[model samples]
Target chain A: MNIDAVVDFNHWRDQARLLLQQGIHPTAVNWSGQQQTQLAFDSPPATAESSRAYAAGQVPKNFIKLARAAACYRDESRWALLYSLLWRLTHGESHLLHLVTDPEVKRLRHMAQAVRRDAHKMHAFVRFKKQQINDREWYVSWFEPSHLIVPDTADFFVKRFNTMNWSILTPDACAHWDQNRLQITPGVDQPNALIQGQMSDDMDKYWLQYYRHIFNPARLKTQAMQSEMPKKYWDNLPEAALINDLANGSGQRTQTMLDQAPNDPDRLRLKSKKLRQQQDAIRSKQYPSNSAPDQWMN
Target chain B: MQLMDKLAVLADAAKYDASCASSGTTRRDSAGGQGIGSAGGTGICHSYTPDGRCVSLLKVLFTNFCIYECSYCVNRASSQVRKARFSVAEVVKLTLDFYRRNYIEGLFLSSGIIQDEDHTMEQLTLVAKELRLKHGFKGYIHLKTIPDASPELLKEAGRYADRLSINIELPTQQSLKMLAPEKSIQGITTTMSRLQAGIDEAKSQRKNRQTISNRRSQATFNFAPAGQSSQMIIGADDSTDGTILQTSDRLYSQYRMRRVYYSAFSPIPDASSALPIQAPPLVREHRLYQADWLLRFYGFSTQEIVPTVGPEAGMLDLHIDPKLAWAIRHRDWFPINVNRAPLELLLRIPGIGARTAHKITRVRRHRRLRLADLQAMRVPLPKCRPFIETLDHTPAASLLEQDNLRRHFIPPVQQELDLFQAPPTPLVTAP
Candidate 1:
């Protein structure tokens, strides 16, 4: 880049600093000034000493200096710094301009990707199961998020279900809702192990049956289907356990599941076998005996 | 077909119109419904922005094939554009696919008047029916009601749709007739009236059901639970701001519309002889929106907003916003005591939005707020300064010199001749 053609980089840097000091991001700064500055000289490392001092709880001489320096750069880099700073403050970890990891790090990396997807699922799925607990009713939902979304997702749950007493239990963290006063705590590795009694069983069976009933055979696009409801979550979802059997020998299983008797007629018992029969009946009614339509992708 | 490609074209086409709102509804998932979703009263529904606007749904026309040729519509029948019609099953499939992918929450389905309005409307209604009844889709669905469609089809449309909209085409009856010769202002208003009547009937039915059936009303006869809203194309016809507001005022008063969307008319793909080659200033649409908000929320009347007549007199000033224009014109009203001003007067202050005005009112109850408290609340003090008198601050009484203060607000900054000239030194610097 020709230095002569370049406008004053330092001037833009100063302007950016002024903007940041005033709590403004210089997103709409003149493009000419931006093009002029060489990255090495123009993009100053703000005041490292002041940042260090401020982080250590010492009053720095220039409180606004760092913000100003942050503003001086083009918009993208400024946002990058802001996010990096926020990440560092929250996680107490910083590795700017570098990437290094050991063999064991790959597991965590994979886990992180899974967690990201699960966070999205937590946002997407995790249907609340309404139940009566001791006269005061509440909605209980169990979501096995891949990662730690409890901190973020709790706020959403609180805002959305403010009127109801709800709890979103996950493997890593369990969120409690008492009339919208929400609190999250790190919990046991698996929530399924902790869930009490026949309620979970009945709920799981009901969900599976509902899923089976709604699954349109004609709309099943394999790649698209898997993309939305990944194979990874199949284990946790009870509906997936019956996928192959239902797909291949749906009618037979329907009869066999129906023939099984009710162990406890007096009580609200886990009628998984009966529910599976109902699912089959729904399937037979919707698609009939000829062959499964096999197209339901939604 | 790749859903993304279809979405790109459809969503892009839908973006030109501003009528996809999913609020002001009271629809929810039914028992044994495969999915659980809700549409509540808050108009805070989602929207997408390919250009930074919110994307609420996969808004698209069922087909851009129409019988009536609206001069300003890109999808007008005479325009030579590639047209596609999604089958009932196809539309249902597409909505489910898009929704499942988490690309959108629902569908905002519109169509050009194919064959006839009744024929097109029935097809559109069928798509909603499948989404709700056959598929048990609990996602939000907004169906555009054709103005000439039967009251029966319109009623069925409301049963499934979270929201329904009827485009008024243009502001004034004269403009609508001149531009869209086929479109009847009476037809548009009649549809709106039918929708409102249906809504009232549903509300009564719901009330009656509460007394009759202790159980939740599964009446399924609910009329546009999200409520009916209409859209007007700004700058398309020779409609003045006064005319536009008067029309909107009537729509709100008569049909009880939830909203009156202002769509700035973009030139048709194939321009008609009557249509302008150039697009209207998008800012005019924005101004209309602001004006509409003032009417609905800030308690401004049509007469107050566009009181003057003449070619330029009756319109909103382009440079300054509508509210700011009002404040500048009505200087006698301001220098209002922030500590003591009523909610109505406080709302009239430029840059002090409804939220801030409410905040000021609330904070004043506990402890009177000084200028600092208002500043902390994020109220734009620069504009507010001319209007409000706090404990620590007051506008110079001389600010009532209308022209002088108006100039200050707009700021007499000299536009650069080219790029080289230096800005003149400031005459006076306010501390």
Candidate 2:
């Protein structure tokens, strides 16, 4: 069996099933994709054109789930690897998927891990900008994910921000939800068309302001932040614009705070005896000294 | 005062809380509701602050106006810091605005005492109620429960909140009294116990309701699905790491708390005389978190993690991580065969994390693991090399027992990279 390109997990699953049905071995297959080359199949392409259901009684539910995720990986060998795993599963090693230490199994799990992380990061880093699509308001985000995870991560956005209409555009694929159902589109080499949704958002200022002040100068750990947020995401993130400003000013701001003289209690004493009296009354009632502290503090 | 001004003051006051978790909640979304938002799955870190903390929630205090003066708190009544309060409506609006802009996953609302426990708890719970019942905001709501709040109020807060917490403030009752005199240790424990009961009851009730053929609304029974978490301030008093771990163990064993955050006693504006002048070492906080991870995931006892024979005796080793430090102190347990070791033994090996150890155990079912397998899994080879026996690699007896072994594991001081000047790379994984 031969195939030109496997676009997504579903595409890979469909073709792999066809090959398995015909009893074609992994060694007898050549799987290639992610390029726009002309299609060439030795006998016939591994397509579902004339294919019926393969009678392999349900592949392990766990393997299917793992392979589906692993297929999101960009590694060109991912299809072949998954096909090999599937072949091994039905052919001989029944519990092959459970053997996590097997080099082949380990590789599949690694690919799945990468895909899962990609999907999670896609959810975290995607920045939405409010745009007027048609006559209604829509939230649009332009994200550059490492793998083909736009489809895998779409449902998360649907469950999360489902009350609003939104779309996520990426180089690999695109996902849009209009309250009713989700619509997915094929990959585009360039996102120039998608970028037209909205250039800027006004609420970005409040977000940026929060970002600036929320950072504590006393603790400067850019590596820790970068490890999670990463530098690649700094561009699209509205709050990321202040990463440098916050980082560079941290040392100085911390020094200034440290340099300032401790507040003089005498000044409070000088703020009129009435102010002190009021404080005393509140303090006595608040503390209730030499007694059990109140169980609840409001 | 303007809402923005109040937000600045209250948010600054609330930053001391180390938790901003929005995960582990009863999943809900606004698909059929009137307003916009949703909460489910593992929480997302919408942003990261330079303090190296995930800005997962819109963490803010409902008010910084306090009558009880907890010495460690910036919003203490005796402190000179400015005070501000937010109406329930204002908090709801701010949360929605931030959620709309993709700035946060949810809201974490804590407050200082105002008027009385009932009034304060009412204000806090009202914000959550309005977000859930009125706006139909399904985003995560974490309410910092007051120890003195009525049980009914606490239960109601649980209804609208995904998580609730009562900050213990300090490890020992003595320290809590010395530092936060107005906070009762007895009251705090009672609240924790009550919260535990409420959370447990909700789970059973939800389960039973499901069996009775109720719709998915049984799943959304307005109970706090994320359960309870607590925070403790370190270095504010004389409690050592051992004492701290004991307290944490008790909390876990007694109430089945989800998370315990250890906040270093960092300096705040208008410092208190009762506390230390400088903040505890950052490494101290780092070690506590590491030890905490060992306690939670790696199945290591707190005693094993804080084994003596280091600077700050009975404290965790600052130079290396708690796992590596434990491996070094208990060298007699080294040289487990990675190909044949049990999952527990594999986890104890210095370089092998839970993920790697689990992988080694699983894959070895079909084939014996080798050094190459570890390499493919991205295990830190040097750290594990001296402790584990893989098919292709094994440490010499001398290497494992050498006097300079600890020095070998210590990572060099990292040179600071100016991320601002560097070109942005392709993609970074959100941890």
Candidate 3:
């Protein structure tokens, strides 16, 4: 294995040829002969009659083809180096000095950026249920991720809920804690069960009721809803079973809600005004618990 | 009749107008009494497309009825199309319903001139006010300003709407008189001026960075926080590409519009004897869009693009995109060194998009670039090669021969089936 060494171009070319001979596809090696050779070497200029030249018999010597061969290898460090070199070569500079100073490593580092971003969004948005375990307390939550992020993301939950026992389970990974540091594991499908030490049915019931109450029937766009909370996550949420019934009977429920209207206009007005303020505060960029750092320097 | 029928009639009538974008402005909900949403002071809007078409709005007209006869409009009073008007309450209910369903992010309400400008503007404001004060909606709202509405009423409309827009109606003031005789350019410009004043005042106060309560008194006249946009009808009037671009330049310079929409004229029913029998080819609309893009994103100027010399000059080529056409016409600008060309020069080349330009700038920071390097950057090397010079490439000057380049741009004659192919030979001969 090449491990972490930054292989030079000549060594890469020789190493790649050996690996290819030993039954590895050129794509599988860090210094694949294809891209390494192209950036390490040079493409002959197309003839002055290049416009008339077609590709049927032309042996392809383009840098793009070479870059793709390098990308086919999964080693990110090699890919970053290759990309940096490829970029420099394309911009009219034919020197290797450009690759040495390129900051293109950020792209390699951020390959998992989307996964991390979405995982944080899930953590912020997910509402957990309370269950009593032998008269103590525990919270249960479920999530569906577009990619595997649970292994790294579970630390956030562990840090936040260190004093309370909790579990966050996803399709691919899970995190469990006993009021201490978190233990993460590859996920297997497991049904929610009452814990022996600290699970309560009353807390679960209260949370479920709150969920039902807050759901707005007025703004029920299924397509928009799906884009935010994908259908794949439906089975894991406690409110999932209630969704169909709520949607189908939305009009009736809304009518019922309207009928139970508060009579004291001033009191109702004050409460609603307060609620709107609170909602605005939560959505504001300055909320103390917001995941992202403050956008404005102030 | 049925809601579906109402939607079809209204949406189809509205489709001729291309000002459906729901961007700019981020307002939080402020209405009291247990409402689901609110339009914040700032306008955070949602457009329609996944490619970032914002939609924080319920963009529909309050009515399609009109008193004045604008020839380009489907809802002009003279047209025989069925018309419908939504009551203030009904419009509110529809908005609330759509908002709850989350099909829309907010409301963009416009209307045909009914009764008079004051009455229509008042009604439109009521929808925004009701959605704000009554329903307590906090989503983004954009309202179309009435050209002759009372300043007080227009002010109210602005207070509630996240953004405001006024259609310039057509490209040229002369075209406006010819196509829409009832409307006056002076009236439209006056309202735009007033709205601009309001926007400028609010912006100045906001820049002071005072609290909302402190700013509220200073914000006595709330214009569109998201700013304003306008639309121009293409092909309806005999405005040339040069004239249209010049007007867009003036609007951007004068009114500070956030965006300008170009709505291609669709064919009229039982078309007027004065109107052309066939609409301008769709390609004309596409070319106008390309030209507009060039003006906005590319560094091309109105005069620079239209030309001062040569035959068939001063008119955009209907066959090729404006940038490509410009590149083909001005071959002297070729062989720009991609490694060292300024961002402005790079933007002039076809197939080297803004993103690719940025990519090129970023990638070239560390190394010298070559012909093969561009292909890796995904720059359209085939199109760009003729214009750019890299370490590995230097094309012959014959690459710019007018005939050769023109052949590549304008497809084979079999492809250009014009809209009026069946018109009498004599009609084609007309100027």
lDDT of each: 0.59, 0.78, 0.58
DockQ of each: 0.02, 0.35, 0.03
Looking at model 1 chain B, report the run of 10 residues with the lowest lDDT sum.
B422-431
Name the candidate that leads on TM-score. 2
- Chain B TM-score, candidates in order: 0.90, 0.92, 0.86
lDDT score of residue A150 within candidate 1: 74
Query: Candidate 2 chain A: worst 10 consecutive residues by lDDT?
Result: A289-298
What's each prediction's TM-score?
Answer: 0.59, 0.87, 0.59
Candidate 2 stretches greater than 4 Å from native: A33-58, A98-104, A186-198, A264-298, B32-35, B211-221, B308-312, B392-394, B411-431
Interface RMSD after interface superposition, each candidate: 24.8, 4.4, 20.1
Query: What TM-score should be assigned to candidate 1?
Result: 0.59
Per-candidate RMSD, Å:
23.0, 6.6, 17.2
Best model per lDDT: 2
lDDT per residue, candidate 1, B178-249, as tens digits?
Answer: 677567566676677778888888888888888977888454467777788888887667667777887888
- Per-residue alpha-carbon lDDT of candidate 3 for residues A1-298, written as tens digits (9 for 90 to 100): 2322433334444443333233332233343333434333233232232322112222224333343334323354554355344434433445433232234533332333454445644543444555566887766666666555565556555543444566776666787877655678777664545223233333333223323433444334455555645555555444455667656775665455344422221222255565344323322313133321122111
Model 3 stretches with alpha carbons more than 4 Å out: A1-298, B1-5, B27-57, B210-221, B268-273, B308-311, B401-403, B410-431
